[model samples]
Target: MSDASRHLDARSWKALRDKSPEEVADFSTHLSQPCEVCEAFLERSDEDDAFGVESLADEALGSMSTPREDAVGWARLRRRLWTPRRAWLAGAVAVAAAAVVAIAVLPPVASKEHEDRSWRLKGVAPMSLELSAVARLPDGTLHAVTEDDLLPPEAVVLVRYRASEVSDAMLVLESPEGPAQMLGGYTLEAGTHDLKEAGELAGVSLAGEHGPRVLVLAAWPRGPRSAAARDAALTQRLVPEEAAQARLRLRVEPGYVAP
Candidate 1:
C-alpha cells in the first residue's frame, strides 16, 4: 500500500474509469490503495519471510539427489517451525473468531423497516416502445413520461401502467380528431397508505390481451402532449355519449387500495 492510494477517493477512481478504455487500462496499472490492517499484516509477513525461504530450501534439500546432511538439516527446521499448536492458532485468527459464534447462532429476519413505500406497477406487462423514455425527478421522486420530440408521425403509441405512491393519479384518452380528453379518478396503494388524488394522464389506444379489443386511459407518458390535450383525450374516451361515441370508450378504475 502507498500514501497516494490512501489519498485517492472513490469518486476519483470512478472518474478515472470513465476515461477512454485505453487510458483506464493504463491508469489502473499505476493505481495504488492501502488497507491499514492488511498493510500491517503484509509488513509482518515480510519480516516472517525467513521461514518461507527456509521451508523452500528444505524442500530443495529433500530431493533424491541431495546429500544426506542437507536433507536432515532442513527436515529438522520444518518440524520446529510448523508445529500443530501454531497451525491451530493461525486457523483461529483466519476464522475471525469474534464473529464466528454470532454468525453461527443468529437467524435472518425480514422487517418492515427494510421495505420501500413507493408505488410499484406490480405485474404490468412492459411495452416494446422503440422510443421508450424514463426519468427520475429530483427530491428522490421518479417520473417516467414519454418523449416524442424526435419521433416520426408514423410512430405508434405504446401503453404501460405507471404506478407510484409519490405521485398523483392521472389518465388520458385520445379522440379521433387528435385531441386528448380526461378520464375519471383513480386510487393506488403506497405500501400501507391509500393514495386517492386527481389522476394525471396520457393517451393510450391499444388492444388488450383478449379479443374483445379494448382501449383505455393508461397511467403512462403522453409523449410531449400538453395537459389540455391529455384532459380532452380522456374526456372523449371516458365520457363519450351514445350519439357521439368515439372509436373506443374507456372506463378508468382505481386498481387497488392500500391498507
Candidate 2:
C-alpha cells in the first residue's frame, strides 16, 4: 500500500478505474485507513468527472455533422465515458448519441477561424511529447484554448500533456518580461495527464500577465537524474540527448474578453 499521508498517483487511479483487481483492493484498503487527503482527492475526482462529461457532451453536440466527424467526436466521447467506473454515464452517452445522430443530417458548419496551434518540437527521441492548454471557467467548466485565442485576465489555465513513454518531466514557463519559471516536476507514465491533477500546483494563473508566453515540457527517461540536476538542465535550456520536449506558445491580452 502507498503511504497513508500521500494521495494516490495517476497510475494507481488509472488502474483502479480500469478495474484491476489488485489496484481496487489496494485502494479500498487505503480508503479504510484515516487519510483525509486521499478522501478529498476522491471527491475532487468525482467532481472533475462530472464537469468533464458535461463539457464533452457540449463538444460532441457542436462538432458532429458528417460521418467522419461524427465518428471522431463519438470516439473521443466514448473514450471518456466508457471507463469502468463511469458506467453511470451510459444514460448520458445515449443522450449524446441521440443528439449527435439528429445533428448528422444537418449541413456541416464551416471550420472555426482558429487553426490548431499546438505542435511538437521536430526531433528524434525515444519518447514524443505534446502540449495543450485549457481554461477553467468561473463556473468550473473547461474551455480548450489555442494559440489564436486571447485568454481572459482571470482565466485559470490548466496545462495538459501527452507522452509516448514513461519519463521524468518538468513544466517551465517563459515570459517576455521574466526568466523561465519552473512550474513543477512530474513523472509521466506514458499517457495524457492534466498537470493540475497530477502535481501539487493547482493551476497556472495568467491574471497579471500579458504578451506571448511559452510553456515548455522537457522530459527524459525516468530514474537517471536527481531533481536538482533536472532543474539545472532546464535553467540552461538543455536536456539529455535522448529527452523528448514540446512547447506551447500562448498570448495573454488582459483587456480581451473570452466568449
Candidate 3:
C-alpha cells in the first residue's frame, strides 16, 4: 500500500485498545493507517495497566513520520502478540520494504525499457482497429509517397491520416549494422535484412495489423539518379532488405527501401 493510502495517528491506536472486541474488529477492518501497533496492543488485551502500553504508544506516535524501518518496531510489537515466532522478525521486514520498493519504483523502469525498445528498424504492425487507414496506393506509387511535412519530426510515415499526422509509429532495428543511414528518397543502399535480424531490434504494432508488419526504413527524393546520387546510392546500396519493411504507407520517401 502507498503512504497516500492511509493515515493512522496516536488517537486512532488508543481508541482501538480502549474499544470493545467488536469495535476493535471494526477499527482493524476500517483502518487505512498503519495497523500493526494498534493490533499489537489489542493482542495484549489486558488494558488495565496502562504503564507499558502508554509508553509504547507515545514512542510509536512520535515515530509515525520516521523511516519505515523504525516504524517496523511497532509493527513487530503488534505481530508478537499473535504469532510468537522468533525467527521471522528480520525476514518479514525485508519483505515489506522490498514490496514497497517494487510497487513504487519497478514500474517506471520497466516502462522506460519498453519504450526505448520500441524504436528501431523493424516495421510497424497493426495492434488495433482504432487506427484507420487514410490512404492506400499501388506498390509502384508506394515508393513515391509524399513527405507529410505537418507530422512530427520523428514520424517517418503516416498510416491513414492526411498528409501530416501525429504518429504513434515505433521502430526497432536488428542487423549487426546500426540504423540504416538515411541516404535520401525511396532509394536505399543495397544490403540484406530479415525478420530475424530486424525483429530482434524491436517490434511495432499498428492499430489494425494483427501479426508482424513490414516497414520502409529509407527512401530518396525523386530526381535523376545523378541529382540525388549519394543519398540514392546509400538508400539503394547500404540499407538492408531486412532493415526496412514496406508494410505500411510512408508519408515521406524513407530514402532507403527494401530490395
Candidate 4:
C-alpha cells in the first residue's frame, strides 16, 4: 500500500467517528477509487456500527476530568471496537455504554501504581467477548499489557475474560513451533472473571525467548467433549469452526525495557 493509502486506512475510523467535512471528503474520494481493502473496511465498520460506539466513547471521554483519563478511556474504547476482526454490534454498543458510565463515575487516582494496574482491554472477538492481560513488573507494580506493549522477561501474566453467555473455553499459546495449551476443558461463566482469583488456574509466565506470541481463546457452547476430543480439535484447528475466538498478539523484542 502507498503512504496515502495507509493513512486512509488508519484514519478511516476517525473520519467516520468525527464526521468532519474534510475527513469525510477525503474518505469518500478514496472510496471512489477501486480499492478493495478500503471498501471492505468500510463495510466491516458499518456492520460493527462503528459510529454508535464512537459516539459513546466521545461522550465518555467528554466526562473525564483530565487529558490522561481521556487518553486512557479512548485507548480502551478503540481496542474494544476496532481491534476485533469480527464483532456483533449490539453487544459492542452495550459494552461501550457501560464503559461510558464507568468512566464517568470513577474517581481519578493520583498514584502511578493504581493507575498502571487499571484493567486494560487487550483483545476482542466475536460474540461480544474480550480478553485482558496484566503483567506484574519487576518493581512489583501491575501493568496492563497491550498488543504493542513489550512484556518484561519472565513476567507473570494474569488474565481476565468477559463473555456474553456461559461457554466452554480453551486458552492456547501459538508460537512458531505449534499451539501449546494454556488452559483447556474449562467452563467460562457469563460475565467477567479473573482466572487466578477464581482459583481455576494460577497464571502463565511468558518465556524470556524473544519473538511474537499469540494468545488464543476459543469458546463454544456447553457440550459433551472429552479432554482427548478437545486436544484433537485444537490440534487440527487452533480456532474451532463456528466458534467464537479471541486472539491477542504480543511481541517480545530483545533488550527492550518497559517504561
Cα shift from native, residue 165, model 1 (Å): 2.8
Stretches of candidate 1 off by over 4 Å are 1-148, 152-156, 159-168, 173-179, 183-186, 191-203, 206-259
Q: Write the per-residue lDDT of candidate 3 for residues 1-259, one digit (tens) a residue.
A: 2233333345544655566565466655656466675456556655444437557987899988855555557556645642321111221111111111000000011233334432222223221111111211213221222322211111222221111111222222222234432312322212321111111211122222222222333222222332243343354444322121232322222332323
> Residues 1-259, candidate 2, lDDT per residue (tens digit)?
4545446666667676677887777778877777877766655664335226457777899878754436457646744753221111111111211111000011112233312311222222455677666665555455676654677656666656676766667777778787776665677767765553222323566656778876677776454453554566666654433345676667878666667
Question: What is the C-alpha RMSD, rounded to one decimal, of candidate 1?
Answer: 30.3
| Cα error of candidate 2 at position 119, Å | 26
lDDT of 3 at 21: 66
Name the regions of candidate 2 deviating beyond 4 angstroms. Answer: 1-125, 196-202, 226-228, 234-242
Task: Compare the candidates by TM-score and give the number of the best one.
Answer: 2
Better of 2 and 4 by lDDT: 2
In the range 1-259, model 4's lDDT, one tens digit per residue, is 2235543454556655668776776666666778878656654664446557557877899978754536457546744753322111211112211221100111112344434422211122335456766655557556677765687555655556776767666777667765454444466778876543223333456644467777666665444542333456565654544445666777766666678
lDDT of each model, Cα atoms only?
0.30, 0.56, 0.29, 0.53
Off by more than 4 A, model 3: 1-174, 177-216, 226-236, 239-259
Predicted structure 4: lDDT: 0.53
Residue-level lDDT for 86 in candidate 3: 12
Clashing residue pairs in candidate 2 (N, C-alpha, C atoms within 3 angstroms): none
